[model samples]
Target: MYKILEKEDIAPGEKLYVLDAPDIARKAKPGQFVIIIIDEKGERIPLTIADFNREKGTITIIVQEVGKSTMQLGNIKKGEGILNVVGPLGIPTHIEKYGTVVCVGGGVGIACIYPIARGMKEAGNRVISILGARTKDFIFWEDKIKTVSDEFYITTDDGSSGKKGFVSDQLKDIIDNKEKIDLVMTIGPAIMMKVVSETTRPFNIKTVVSLNSIMVDGTGMCGSCRVEVDGKTKFACVDGPDFDAHKVNFNLLNDRQKVYLKEEKEAHKKCRLEERISGNK
Candidate 1:
């Protein structure tokens, strides 16, 4: 069992957990993830390693309560023990001095991209970051991201923050201005990553994106997080949570993600009903 050292509600329906995971923290890297089991009967869920402090022996994960399991995880507070926290799983990002690298993130995906951008900067690259959310209130960690980014831009779909468009729009402006981006990395909803991939493909910029497919086991034994890249089958758990965006089959991934929609809705409903019933006591 891993103790939750601290918990904070970073945004609506989103929470950040600082866990006492010394082993994982020591080995954790940017672009890797951890599979968490809230309790004995809990479902295993994969979450990106948002940040890690070797000295503190803690790893931070940002979770958005989008499903039943996630909602349950969100209810866990500081000092509670997470039943199982397994990993620093998957390959870490390939960091190199790629001159100028642009890191793009959207919604809760910003948490996934934060460490990658920091890694890029630390590797002697000028990191330009772009983050977006549905509205101003949905965004978090802008200051933290900017501290590591050479240039940072934020956007909102409703013009509630930095810009009145998508992160792609800001990216296009940078590309059009001939900023000479050597590499582009993005993490977000599949659709958003697909758009970023498409945007950079024209310029033949090497683009890497993290795939959030349905995952059961973190060890790739379940085969639930399968995805197609470059016309071949790849598992997101063991093979990657990150892949060449230009090569991934986003349409299939997007469709595959919806396979559990009905079940998820039902489960979420059940959780809500249980919450209300428990509250009434």
Candidate 2:
């Protein structure tokens, strides 16, 4: 059992958990993820590795309370143990001195993009970061991301914070200004990533996106996380959670994400009802 070392409610529906997983932490890299099970009967869910402390043997995961499993995970306190924590999974982001790199994050994807931006800066790349959320309340890690970025911008759908626009808009501005962008890495909702990819495609900017497909197992055997990249099938679990944004079929990826929507809502509803009953008792 992997023990929870700490828990913090970072945003309205987002919780960050630091777990004691020495092996995984030792091997963890930016752009990889973990499959966690809250309990024996719990379903496996993949969460990107948000941060890691190698010396402390801990890995941090930021989760938004969007489904039954994540809600259950939020109820778990520090010192409690998780049934399973399988990871350091997926290919790590290719880090190099790729000149000026733009890292874009939307909503919870901000958490996923943090470490990668830091890594890029460390590799001597000029990191420009753009963070976005629906509102100010959903945003987190502004200071953390800023520390690594040479330049940073924030946007919100509502004018609650930063500019009243999307991350794609900010990116477009940077592109239009003729900034020399060597590579662009984005992690966010599929729609947001799609827009960012489209924004860069015309200029032929090297763009990468992290795909959050429907993944069952952390291995390729399950075939649940297969995505079409460059018109070829690739499994997100083993092949990558990262791929060339231009070559990815965003339509298929977005459609596949909806496969469990109805069942997910039902599960969340049942879990909520059970929690209320338990609270009453």
Candidate 3:
């Protein structure tokens, strides 16, 4: 059992947990993820590693209560033990001194991008990070990300904080202003990443995106996290959660993401109902 060492609510519907997983923490790298099971009967779910403290033997994961499993995980308090925490899985992001690296993150993707940005900086790259959310309320870890970034920007659809625009818009402005960007890495909603990819494609800049695909098993055996890169099949679990953005088939990725939408909504609704009933009891 993996024990939760600390837990905090970072935003509405979002919770951050620091878990005591020394094995996973020691080997954890930026851009890898873990498959978590809340209990023996709980379904497996993938969450990107937000941060890790090897000395402390802890890893941090940020969870948004989007579906039943996440909501269940959110209710788990500090000191509680989870049934399974299998990983440091997936290919780690290739870190090198890529000159000027721009990191773009949206919503909960900001959590996933934090470690990567820090890694890039440590590797002697000038990291510029752009983070966005629907409104300011959804943004978290701004100070944490800012510390690792040489240049930092934030955007909100509602103009509640930072600039009133999209992260892609901010990125475009930077590119248009003749910034010598060596690489661009983005993680967020598929649509947001797709837009970022499109924004940089014309410049022939190297761009990478992290794919959040469905998975039953962390291994390649499940075939559930398959993605098409440059018209070739690749598994997100083993091959990568990161891929060359210019060669990725975003249309297919977006379509595949919707496959379980209805089921997810139903499950979320059921979970809420169960909570209400239990509260009344």
Candidate 4:
């Protein structure tokens, strides 16, 4: 059993869990994720490795309570043990000095991109980060990201914090200002990433994105995480959670993401029902 060493509420409905996984933490790298099961009967959920400390033997995973599996995970507080925690999985980010690189993250995708941005900066790249959310309360890890970034821009639809626009808007501004951006890495909603790809296409800026958000059953045996990249089928679990944004088929990816929405809602309802019953008892 993997024990939870600490838990912090980073944002509403989002919790960061630091787990005691010596082996996994030692081997973990930027852009890899883990498959965790709260209990024996629980379904496996893939969570990106937000951060890891090899010396402390701990790995940090930020969980957003979006569905049954995650909500169940939220209830498992610090000191509790998880039934399974199976990785340092997926391909690590291709980190190298790529001149000025823009790292974009939308909402919870910020957690996934944090480590990547840090690694890029450490590798001698000038990292410019853009973080966006619906409102100010939704944003987290500003200080951490800022520490690794040469320049940082924040955006929100409501203008509650930072600039009042989307991350794509910020990207356009950066490009329009004649900034020499060699590469762009983005992780967020498919729609957001698609927009980012479109924004950079004309400028010929290389963009990398993570498809972990749409993935299910990280073992690749399920084929549920299969996505079309450059008109060819690729599994996110084994092939990559990271891919060139321009070559990715965003239309098919968006469609595949909706495949389980109805079922997911039903599952969340069942979880709520069980919770209420247990509370009453």
Model 4, 2-70: lDDT tens digits are: 999999999888899999999999999999999998887988888999999999999999989999999
What is each predicted model's overall lDDT from 0 to 1? 0.93, 0.96, 0.95, 0.92
Question: Lowest summed lDDT over 10 consecutive residues: which window, candidate 2?
Answer: 272-281
Ranking by lDDT: 2, 3, 1, 4
After superposition, candidate 4 runs with Cα above 4 Å error: none
TM-score of each: 0.98, 0.98, 0.98, 0.97
**All-Cα superposition RMSD per candidate:** 1.1, 1.1, 1.2, 1.3
lDDT of 3 by residue, 103-193 (tens): 9999999999999999999999999999999999999999999999999999999999999999999999999999999999999999999
Clashes of each: 0, 0, 0, 0
lDDT by residue for model 1 (1-281), tens: 89999999999999999999999999999999999999989998999999999999999999998888988887777998999999989999999899999999999999999999999999999999999999998899999999999999999999989999999999999999989999999999999999999999999999999999999987879888999999999999889988999999999999999988999889988999998999931
Candidate 1, run of 10 with poorest lDDT: 272-281
- lDDT at 208 for candidate 3? 98
Instruction: Please name the candidate that would achieve the greatest lDDT relative to the true structure.
Output: 2
